[model samples]
Target chain A: MDLRQIWILYRHEVRSALRDRSIVVMSIVIPLVMYPLLLWGTFAAMNFVEGQAERLTSRIAVQDAPPAHRDWIDSLSGMGGVSVSEWMDDEASARESVARGRMDAFVRFESPPAEGAGLEQNFQLRVLYSAARDRSERARSQVEEALVLYRGAWIEGAREDLGISDPEWSGFAVVQEDLATPEEATRFLLALMVPMLTLIMVALASFYPAIDATAGERERATWETLMTVSASRGSIAAAKYLHVATFGAMGGLLNVGALVLSLRWILAPVAGPEGVGGGGLPLSTIPIIAVGTVLLGLFVAAGMLVFAIFARNFKEGQAAITPFYMVTILPAIFLQSPDIELTNRLALVPVINLVLLLRSAIGGSLALGPGLLTLASMAVTVVLAVTFAQWVMRREDVLLGSAGAGLWEFLRSHFLRRKGKA
Target chain B: MNREPVRTQALTKVFYDESRGQVRAADEVTLSCSEGEILGLLGANGAGKTTTLRMLSTVLRPSSGKAWIMGHEVRDAPEEVRANLGFYSASTALYPKITPRETLRFFATVNRYPADRVAGRVDHLIERFGLGDYADTRVEKLSSGMKQKVSIARTVAHDPPVLIFDEPTVALDVLNAIELREIIADLRGEGKAILFSTHIMSEAEKLCDRIAVIHGGRILATGTLDELRETTGLHYLEDIFVRFAGARNAGSAERENAG
Candidate 1:
């Protein structure tokens, strides 16, 4: 309850944590190197996969092809995702064969233009397939793409009046929006990372330290000295909890800062000389994120402290507290999925809210109420966790780590005797 | 007539366990210590002496008993009790990264001493404990004896009315132990009620005004060394402990309730 005590504990905990080389590496270095590498790698891999899928081909049979346009139509077979074979039988026969799953897709080419008269050149390429088949839709799309490619040259020749000769050779017209706001784009990109990273950082910062300070103390026999001090048990627990929570909050803030810096540097080259426009998220959201991150850190720390305090030793505390990481990580993983909505009910869920909020921020659809609700829920959860941990802290078995055989003998003689008779 | 610093009546603690059922870490134990007195609680590893100290310190809550420290009820006024006491033991861990000076100052600040007084108190403690040579060194770099000295300094940084030690010299060398014994006697002389737990008979005999033999979560016998010797019909305190703790009467309820 005393702010000074809490601050004192927080300061020392932060100092101790910073002194640890592993924590420093995890907090600053890993994210600095890993975030850009992972994001660039993922973007490159996705593009590669899409290009490969576009290049794949499927064989097709041609039906009812007229003589004049045979050459033009046959040229379509060379395009990607397409393979063509001539129709040997009549229309009825081909139709029957197609229905019985005899072909991937059957394309019928219409008659070509006559000589001298200049009859309109039009080709009806009908791709036939049963809808129920797995590859039918894919087969249909491939045929369509090949046809477009084959007629591309002809379409350009027709548009020669507009100086469009050799249309196939003319490259695409690039419409650059000249997006000037790297901060906005960065926010968008980070909306996903921020939520997950914040949760993870908070949980990590709070959990291990709380256990080390409390249950670890008991296991090491240091809790005895701590108890003997004139500080109240609650005060002691609070001090420890506040100290760890501050570490968690610091981690979250550092991660966010690192993410922002990385964004500015990476996007600088691509946003052209005229820097990205739109003043990122309003300044108001900064406070929200900061406060939210701090609260989450406290919640996780208090919760973890409860568990750590109850654990018999460092190893036991770890075992007790490790499952919480999953709760923190789940929100980040769910953010990766494309199909999700930020809703009021989702806000009440702990890490899930962080994910949704981050996604909304990135997508430029952030709703303030949901984020506040999420923060409130996190606060409630942490309080409950701390209270439960305190309850366990009050127990002797947890405090003394079974106390060996004397405890068993005392239980047998003292109270169990009365219980058995009843 | 009003010098008692610690008082307990039927102090007991029961722990519920999922795998092995229930455990009683401390059983109906009543005892008292006057101000300026050193009471030594002697027991084997699991004899509930630590648990009893924990209860008296307001660190562990008793299941169905009452304890008072510095005239404050441990159950109802834990904060007040904590405010008036200092406890130390071998098991008490020191923050290894912090220097002895920093650790002592941190404790002092938390106990709400004036900011100006912290430096003076810390310097006095450093000199008193003979830690001037390594006051700036992190606990990780300090010798075991030096670390013990720092722990002692940190525990008494606020100069509380009560001081408790649970095997305060368990791992130290003889010289450090001697220094600690002197400090304990000095603190008692300054009118601080001191309770300590130790297995060493000599340390108890030298320091304690009264000694209690604890076993199986209960205090079996308590008296001055001569009083215990005469009552148990044994000249040595260890023999007296063995007599009470090893007796068949101690296991009578255990035998009747065995399933």
Candidate 2:
């Protein structure tokens, strides 16, 4: 592309973008205002959740037990997180307690066994749980485990000839994941939000202004004068791309700034305040995450401008940028998945790579090679997109607002006609 | 051949609509205009006059034809062709925020004016176009006449060899239109080849050295007023135009009636 013409288009795009109030709000103001509020809200929510989880105590009702099952029921009442209450033969009364949410669960025992028969001949216990209870599901599972332990011991005593060692193996085996610092958890959450915000800001700042300056001008027929000059079209496109990219980059940077300033506040409950030993999250990684966020933001903005130029007018330009919004939001949704991580190959997946990289950086274990590769991949992708955009600029139909014409018509007529044989 | 400033052969621009098939905006049109002359292009609305001017100016490439502007092929050497021409039309929009001076300077830079001469070029055009008074005013706030003048200034700032104008005075008042005519005359006097499209027969009669009457993307006839008068046996240029264009439309009407 000719640098001079591109510069002219770029300058106009940037100037127009700066003048738009909506673009400015979406790109800069919204992030600046929203980040702090969101951070404060998130921290508040996390604190509330932690408190609720810790204070929870489940109340369960037990009924209809034979004398042989009495000891087992008593053992369950002894468990720390569960409060067991006895109920008479009326199952309806116990169920009412569960419905009222006064009791998390209720248990009932069957008929008594004959003398000289085993406890298996006696009775089974039934546990009824309240759906409203948050930890009622876990409490119910623990109750079942207690019953199984009793049954296993009875079966082992009955089968003395069979060689069985570990009867408690199936009851409760804890599987522990590597413990992450509170900072890591906070970074995980921010990774989802930061990339999406950056993408959105870039798109808003660049798309409309780029369209207004280029396609909009052309549709108004003013571009004829620009094109009639000695300037090459390539140069004009280059200038325009540069101008748009700068605006988009600025928006991304502003969002990054907002996030950096609000990071500690937003993640305080999860990561805690600096110098307080409860949270392992470091507030210092904010700058590192900001760099990656800003780079990704620029790429998004430039790409949006290139795509927005395909629109026939300002209104159509807005419609055309819908996919870009989806592109940004889609990756943020992926970060909510517990399995997603910052792997080497994932760094090449466009916007997701930025989020993943930022997550790893904030979490304090980013691999340098993957981070650099992600940057390189983004640069290469940007280059390819820009090249395609240059070709679109060269196309008379695209420049003239005829880019939306049916593909078959373009192929059978314009493209085929250019090939001479058609 | 005279040094033709603009020439086209079989120039056709077909606009395809999904709902409606191919609409021939400009169809199989062969034309040429020599240097240092004023060629008036006359056509009704949707008759492809603007499209023709666009192709000649290298703004819109022809769908399946060839054109040369100042000896440079528009398709192959668009930049060279663009470098050699100035173009203006009423449809041309102005940048809303920037002043006329800034817009012109920006265009001048893109047009590759020598750094030493860029300032002088902008100044000359600003003074010559009478935009000196409002050169620093944002174009969005400028009067229509003033904006028109700025558009003209922008077009002429680089002083190319050819100029194409398409109904540039469409929205202008009588006084502004006359001033624009005067400006066109002045530019022509400097020996720059000029092509202008207009529906106004009087303007074409007064300003054009030669006239090409076009209808339905096809030129029906072209000549000096005297030549057309001799051929059509009509006193006024409008009479000749009406006789030929009216006959073509009437014949099509008759065929449709018969069918």
Candidate 3:
């Protein structure tokens, strides 16, 4: 196996892939443009919805309140987010109005408050609203808040009448503190999304090029010519694998960069001004993530090339590669759960280990041992996949497009036949 | 006497078919092509013409046999064998996205042609094959004849001593086929040992210095045209082939009946 020959084959594969417009569009353009647009669109939509919600005014009606409650109803009208109106119908009619969206909510007082009940007042208040309607729910909460304030004022007035001036009688103060830094919280949120997105983009980036290089050659009837050349099958397969791995790595990097840049705006409201980058992963973690991306890219690319070569044509290659893509994605989705961590056992798994390692690395908590383990595991798998690809290429029936047994059955028979000959 | 550029001893290939048990795609066949000689492998489709050519080119492994290209054993030294031989089939295609020049350069580099001589050799072949106008055009945009010209140029880019062509004219128009015959004659003039397979009797008659009649994975006869005619008592090559194939079929039927 000549390294120069491998380089020549690799260069040709890369040049061919570059010339293919579909591969260029799928790998580079989509990652660079689509992610930013998708992120910007989502953020803009959320902002618009929030603005609309804030400007909305909800109407509330009072039902069956005695004339003596006029002052309290007038106070409710003075508050914001509500337009209190007279209820000329029964309780059912007020509820029907709320359900129909004509009124946002209704406050039904079962009976007028006892004349001088003071602190022991025992009156039933029912707040009716359509839970399915956002405005109705908002209006009900506002009305409830106003009533609580009014009750507080009444209690304060009674306390003044009794000449009680101690402020401690209001309630005990409850203070809350969040232990997480802005970075840690942002990392938590990004850990769920970034890894999955990166894996998906890597798969997409490598898919077309892998299929184009292997099965595409066969479909174009160029495989036989390629095989007859002086280059060893191992060199040829390695060159193709390098071409696919380069695309996969580029995709992974571009996706991470795009996600980082876009999430600054996309997650601003959720993660604050520092956003996805703020306090989350340190600048040092970038190199670690970069390394992980390359390893994962190589792993996935090798696996995809092996499967793609089994197919006789481009469409058949796509069909053959879909299940592999799905299998890789399943582990990524499983890794999205915060409960799954980078443990020794998990580090032994292929795709799952890479995702976990990336998540840990990006979140700035990657331990040295497990990170090394994940890298080593992926490297071994890539080697095995590439070896298998080289073996497949040497088979006469496969290279010549002759009808034969399925790959596994053929390999089994081939090995047994060799053993018998020996 | 010139050295033999291609030789085989008991070359064979067996394919296992679920319905037919074991099918001998190429039986224990032995033949040789010497420098400055053109050996036309004459056989109909499915008569092991391709299977035999493929084994000699090291594209398919012989089940139990030895073959050599320019004295390099195919199985033991495939890279050396490939370095010394050029194989072309009618179905062989060029990379569609690459230009003809680029295709030749790729082949030259892979075949380890001297780095300094690749460009000059490629240019000479381009002019020789009348591909100057489409040398820089993507192969997918080239006409079928032009593409075949590029294919043949790339096959011989390293100037190997042995050339194997399998049905090279099967897809070519009459003009292109005639052009290919001229190219094969030129290669022979350059003292390259050329073995090509063809079912077209006239093509074999016009181009082959010697003919090897193949049928059912075995060569029935091999000699000069007159020598073959004298042996089979048939004047035309087609009638000679029919007699050979018919006799083999009758023998097989008789054996089946006896069983």
* Tens digits of per-residue lDDT for model 1, A128-233: 8656654555666677776676677666666775575555445685667947366566565556556777677666656656666766566656666555554555
Ranking by DockQ: 3, 1, 2
Name the fnat for model 3: 0.82
Q: For every model in order, what is the iRMS? A: 2.4, 2.3, 0.8
How many clashes in each structure?
Answer: 10, 15, 2
Per-model TM against the reference = 0.71, 0.71, 0.88
Segments of candidate 2 deviating more than 4 angstroms: A32-192, A218-225, A262-291, A302-307, A368-373, A405-422, B1-3, B14-24, B63-65, B247-259
Best by lDDT: 3
Pairs of residues clashing in candidate 3: A183-A279, A183-A280
* Alpha-carbon DockQ of candidate 3: 0.77
CA lDDT of every candidate: 0.72, 0.73, 0.84
Candidate 2 fnat reads 0.69
In the range B133-236, model 2's lDDT, one tens digit per residue, is 89888888899888888888888777777888899778889999999998998988988889989988899999999988888788888888888888899988
Candidate 2 CAPRI classification by DockQ: acceptable
Please report how far candidate 2 places residue B6 from its true position, in Å. 2.8
Off by over 4 Å in 1: A28-194, A197-207, A215-221, A270-285, A368-422, B14-27, B112-116, B173-175, B245-259
Error of 2 at A325 (Å): 1.6
Give DockQ: model 2. Answer: 0.42
